[model samples]
Target: MRMRHVWMTAGTLFAGLGGHLQASDWNMPVGVTDVSREVYSLHMTIFWICVIIGVVVFGAMFYSLFRYRHSQGAKAAKFHEHTTVEVIWTALPLLILVGMAVPATATLKKMYDASDADLDVMVTGQQWRWHYSYLGEDVDFTSNLATPREQISGESEKGENYLLEVDEPLVLPVGKKVRLLLTADDVIHSWWVPELAVKQDAVPGFVNENWVRINEPGIYRGQCAELCGKDHGFMPVVVEAVEQEQFDTWLAERKAAAAQEAQGVDREWTMDELMERGEQVYGSICASCHQADGSGLPPAFPALAGNQALLDEPERHLDTVVNGVSGTAMPAFRTTLNPVEIAAVITYERNAWGNETGEVTQPADIADMLSE
Candidate 1:
């Protein structure tokens, strides 16, 4: 009765665990793409193959243990390895491995074939953000994590998306082969979107390519699969797949806005305007490292809030921002940011956090500095 109860308890425990796993979805998602589904199939096939092998091998061992027990007066028969048995075991495993490899190889071949893509997008990974340039579309933008600071600091309730949301998502047209040329600006990072079954490394000074075609129109989110830096966990990738018409419309709107922004490159701006725009730019680009409050997490990221050097030397600050300090995490913003953006962010940094520099560096000033 005790043995039976023990068995019953073990069975109950396994049953409960199985139920919990099922509820929590302890399995890869059946993604909405052909390659994703194929990958899922491959994963399940290998898993089931392992399960079957385990069951057969363990079943025979357990049966032998029970049947050959000394308590039952069974004599142990010691024998050397039989050639036939050895050959059978080895051949079976080899055949199983070959079978698994064939499909995996085919899937890999399909993944590598990024030819005849409908669109090409250059994806550049920074310390904690993604810069996307739509090749042949005249659209470019930096996608940053949009999750509020309060939620991240545990001061406010987390949203449904939480760390998975971004200010600007990579938008793609459904049923189109979108090829991504991945590279990094500073360190090695990974561009991963599981629903599309595309995960490629973004290494500095080198480019890697991957393609994906979304079968459905929806929002899919992922994170940086590689550890880049302190804020690696904060970088998220959001993809919004839409119809071709909708995608074209979005592209047109983006191009129009880009043109309008370019017009302001030579125009002078007020301090209030610079500060307002700078606040937005700073939050998106600078906040991840120096923090939202300018009280940086040193000794890596130095505090920008009350730095005496920054308050005193305005030209030095501009030079540093344009041409970053060597052997540090600071990246040169000359190519990344336009004159207006650089001016605004510089002004904001000097004036914000009660430093009260009362500086209003304009785009013309930045342009002049760039020329020299």
Candidate 2:
């Protein structure tokens, strides 16, 4: 009865461990793209090969241990060397490795073939956002984290998408070869989307190439797989794969919107219009480093809520916004933002959060500064 109890306890312990192991099983995700699926297949093939090797080796070991035991009255056979066993062991492992390398080489060849891509999109990684430019399409935009501050700060319950959502997703057409020309504005950031089996490093001053062809239409989410800065984790990548017709429609709409915004550069924007637009631009671009209320995370992101220097010197403020502070996280808005957007955000910063400068910077003022 005591022996039975001991065995039962041992079995229970092992069973619990097995359950935990099962719960934490390492299963490679089978992605929606052909290359992703192929990668997964290769992974499984290698995994199973190792598993089979382990089973055969360990099986023989345990069988020899039990069968050749002294308790079984077995006699030991002594030998100096066995050439057949040695040769078999070496040759077998070499053949197995060669077999594994062949398929792996072919897969790599397929992955690197980015020629004859149907579309080209320039992906520029910034501090905590992604800037996408549709080459030859006259469409460009910056995608920011759309998740609210309240949810991130635990003031409210998390949403279904949570940190995975972005203001604008990288839209692509299904079954089309889309080549990405990746680069970074500041530091190194890796643009990775697992479902597409595309992970390329965006190094500053160097452009890396990667391509993907999606088989299915769906929303795929990924994050910056590089340590960039303070808000590295906040930079998420979202891709929306749709049919060719839908993608074309989206492209056209985006181009039209871009044209309208370009026209706004010549017009004089009112205080109310600038304020409203500035609020939106600030929330998306600036709020990640600076707090939502403009009470920035100090020592890194200085507070704009009651910044006396910013309010007193308007020219200095405009210069700072257009040509960013060197050796710091503040990015220049000259290239990333249009004249209107830069003007509005600056005007908003001066007036909002109880500073109440009541200053309205027109787009023409920004255009003049940029031209200078």
Candidate 3:
């Protein structure tokens, strides 16, 4: 009973500090960030220190008020100042601040040093999605929210990680520094993680870099914090930090896959083969915006079916796909997608939805694109 009372007292005192502190103490899972854990510790430390100071100062103030009350017929003595008392009060807080600065400075230094990274990734924030490019590697793809529209509108039960699941996660090797270079394709987006304690802005035309190294392998989730657009809440960040060996194997496979795709340029593909392959590529790459049926979301992603641009000139369509229009939202596929995937998607678009110009884009055409 005595121990219980002691615990209750401590709990009550802790409860007065902050609501967020309770979240950490309760082991409630939030963002996967080490910095958040550090911040929580700092918060609790400062909170307790403030509590102790408050109790001491306020206790003295209240004691003096009760002991020297006028109703008790005590006469008040008038004094101008207490220089010694003022010095002690001012100096004590200054000393306490210096003590707090030590941990804070260390954390700040860690946050700033986004250098000597094992892997470098460029994160480009679009209106409602994130595009990740593995620096110096052939792996690059857009990661959009995978949650269904019905669930977002409360029409259906939300999944376990609704609005948090992405088409592709930013994969990394655990225990290595993963430096992220951020920039925006459209509006401003802030990438934030509560656990790693990293938040950096993705601004237009400007690159911002931040780094993180996980101590353990786990799925870390974050979100686009800035008010980007209508689908801002939908754009979530998911990082899968895996063992170093697994990550290496994944990279090796990706490189081998790229090489295999490069070999496809020399081969002759029939229209039927290209069309079938194109459909699969189209579904993954173009379906997000242009939609599955090729109807396309009007006023934004224009329809490809019977459109003058696609139906009238097959060569122009090839040019546009290979070399995306500048000053527009459409990004060039020359670097992101391999020759086979780009050719497949382009061929699929031209032939699908009755836009049949009976045209097929070969991998060689895309290979020649790099020159232009």
Candidate 4:
């Protein structure tokens, strides 16, 4: 009779939680990949096992406390050396663990095998941005958070994808095994996209490999799972998976754009043109440190507004940006940015805010300096 009562109480407890457990938003998403689905299955399997165990334990405790109260003259009953009960308790948990481990091990093995990938992407983590390079494709770009400052500051209403949106999303094709080689340029960071079931640490000087083959065409969003810097929350990852034909067209267009940018290095640039491009590049890359108003956070990032000394030496400004100061937090942008970007940003900084130098620094001059 007691055993039946305990079981009934356990069932009731578990039934109360069933509704929440079935909620899609409450549980792990059955993601857009085969591996992700397997992971979700494993998660639910273990979760239910844990829920059952908790229900049984708590229900028995509650039943005993109510039915065997001291006021009712109920005495504590103790027993020992019962091999049947001992074996049931011991073997039950062991069997459950083993059952959970089997599927988990299989999924982990599949996740680790990143060989013979159709596409290889080198994902580099920086201060608060992600730089993705399509190996052998001669295409690489940085992805920065695209959420407006107004939205963040509570001055304007937030958009649907406020913090998760980016200026450039890492584009990939569905039905292709795209292997990611992740590493950090500075501190340790993690590239995590839950839908793809790929979470790998991006450690400096160490390459971690993970692969994903999206089964759907959609935009998947994620963020850096590691505490990288002050702007850690600002760093977001967006992947747009499209059809093979669409991906091919996008890649070709990117290639053509890159070639055109290379050609720009040999031509003379106008002040207006440089300022426009420079303002954009500055906003994405330099605005974080130097600030949008050119008033940098001093002691670390010195002010760039109304700084006559820096504005006077155009050559020093160029070299400082290219090579970077050895003992400073500023990393060199020579490799990170192209000649056109470099010249345009420098021109923009010199002319922006209260420091209008009116100098037209051509991409050709920046390219020549880089070659030397």
- RMSD (Cα, Å) for all candidates, in order, is 3.5, 5.1, 4.7, 2.8
Give the Cα error of residue 199 in candidate 1, in Å.
Answer: 1.5
In candidate 3, residue 211 scores what lDDT? 88
Instruction: State the TM-score for model 4.
Output: 0.92
Stretches of model 2 off by over 4 angstroms after superposition: 1-26, 69-83
> For model 4, how does the per-residue alpha-carbon lDDT over 223-280 read when each residue is reduced to its tens digit?
9999997789999999999999999999999999999999988888889999999999
- Which residue pairs in candidate 1 collide? none
Rank the candidate models, highest TM-score first: 1, 4, 2, 3
Structural similarity to truth (TM-score) of each candidate: 0.92, 0.89, 0.75, 0.92
Write one digit per residue (lDDT tens) for candidate 2, span 90-156. 9999999999999999999998899999999999999989999999998899999988888988999
Across 1-372, the per-residue lDDT of candidate 1 in tens digits comes to 998998799779856864564335577766888999999889877876887799689989998999889999999778987999899999999999999999999999999998999999999999889999999988889899999999999999999999999999999999999999999999999998877888899999998999998999999999999999988989999999999999999999999988888788788899999999999999999988898899998998889999999999998899889999899999988877878899999999999999798988998878888888
**lDDT, candidate 3, 1-372, per-residue tens:** 998998799787667646655665464343445656676677667777988889889989998999999999989879999999999989998999999999988877877788899889999887677888889996777777878667976999999998889878888898888899999876799987666677799999999989888877888888998998656887899888889999999888877876777788879888888888888767656666677779887877778877886788777777777777777655566655677778888888888898877778887877786666
Which candidate model has the greater TM-score, 1 or 3?
1
TM-score of 2: 0.89
Looking at model 4, how many pairs of residues clash? 0
Model 3, global lDDT: 0.80
- The models' CA-based lDDT, in order, is 0.91, 0.90, 0.80, 0.91
In candidate 3, which residue pairs get closer than 3 Å at backbone N, Cα or C atoms, i.e. clash? Answer: 32-195, 33-195, 33-196, 34-195, 34-196
Model 2: per-residue Cα lDDT at residue 267: 82
lDDT of 1: 0.91
Locate the minimum summed-lDDT window of 10 residues in model 4: 16-25
